[model samples]
Target: MPHSFALQRSSVHSTAFRRLAWGLLVASWACALVSIGLSLARWAAIGHAMDWGRWLPVTVVPAQAMVAGVVAPATMDTAWRWLGVALECIPGLALLYTVLCVHRICRAFLRGEVFGPEVVRGFRGVGWGFLAMFVASLVYQVGVSALLSWLASGQKAGMVVLGVSSFEMSVVVVGLMMLLLAHVLAEGSRLKAESDAFV
Candidate 1:
C-alpha cells in the first residue's frame, strides 16, 4: 500500500534526524571537554611558573595608553583586536548544537516519542558542564587576584580594581545556576506533557 510505504519512509527519516542530532550533541560535548582539559593544563603550567617566582607583571600602561589614544579615537582596529574570533566560535557553535538538540527533543516529545529521560539526562550533562566551567573560572580568577595582590603590595588602587574585577566569579556562578534552572524547566515541561497525555 502507498500509505504503508509513506509511513515507513517517514519513520526512517525521523530516525535519521534523531541520529544526526545526537551526533552533533556528542561532538559538541567532546569539543568542550577537550577545550576545558587544555585550559586546565595551561593553568597548571602558569601556576607552577608563578609558584617558582618566575612571573613578572607585564607593564600594561603603554598598551592601555596606546589603545586609549588611537583605538578609542578611530575604532578601526576592532577586527584586528578580535583576532581570537575563531577561538570564540567554538563556544558559539557548541551552544548552537545544544539548542538544536533541545529543539529535536522537544519535537520528539510532541510526537509522543517518550524521550523524557533522554532530555533530562542531556540537560543534566549541560548543567554540569556549565558548573564545572564556572568553578574553574572562579578558581583561576581567585588565584590570579591573590598573586597580583602579593606582587603589588601597598598598591591600594590596583588592589581595589583587581578585587572589583574578581566579582565576575560571582556572575559566573549565577549564570551556571540559571543554566541549571533552565534544564530543570525543560525537563519538567516534558514530564508534564507526558503526564497530561496519560490523564
Candidate 2:
C-alpha cells in the first residue's frame, strides 16, 4: 500500500483522472457562472413577476414547520432589496470559494499529483471551504429573515425569510468527511515517504 502512488504517471488511470479533472473544472466554473447569472436575473425581477423572497429563502421560524405558497410581497425600497441581495449572495460567495478549491484539486490531479502535499492542501482547502459555506448559509438565514420581516409588508408574524435545509447539513457533513479523508491520506502519504526513504 505504501507503494500505491508508485504507478506510472502515463497509466490509464492517470489519463482518466486528468480527463475527469479537466471536465469537472470546466463544468464547475460554467455552473457557477450560470447560477450567478440566474441569481442576478432573479434580483432584477424582484418587483416584477417574482417576489423579493423568491430567490432568497422564505421559510418558517422552525425548519420543521411547513408553509405552502407563502409569498412575501416585493419590497420596493432600494436599501431593503440591496440588503436582501447581499444576504442571498453570501452563500453563493462561499460556494464560489469552495468551487475554487475544487478547481485547485482538479488541477493537481490533472498534473498527476495523485498523492502529495499539494493534493493534501487542496483537499483541506475544499473541506474548510464547505464548512465556511455552511456558516454563511446560517448567516443568510438570519439576515434574510430580518430583512424580509423588517419591511413588514404582507409578511406573517411567525414567518421567516430563511431557514436551514437538509442540503446545508449535507454540505457540512460532506465537509467533515472530506477533512477526515484528507487527514488519513496525509498520514498515509507521510508513511509511504518515510518507508521509501528508509528503503
Candidate 1 stretches with Cα past 4 Å from truth are 1-16, 43-114, 128-132, 148-199
Score each candidate by Cα lDDT: 0.45, 0.69
How does model 2 fare in lDDT? Answer: 0.69
TM-score of 2: 0.76
TM-score, per-candidate, Cα-based? 0.37, 0.76
Let me know the TM-score candidate 1 reaches against the reference structure. 0.37
Q: With candidate 1 superimposed using the best TM-score fit, by how many Å does residue 176's alpha carbon deviate from the native?
A: 7.8
What does candidate 1's lDDT look like per residue over 47-100, in tens digits? 122333556632221121222231111121333223223333444444444444
- Each model's backbone clash number: 0, 1
Off by over 4 Å in 2: 1-13, 50-70, 152-162
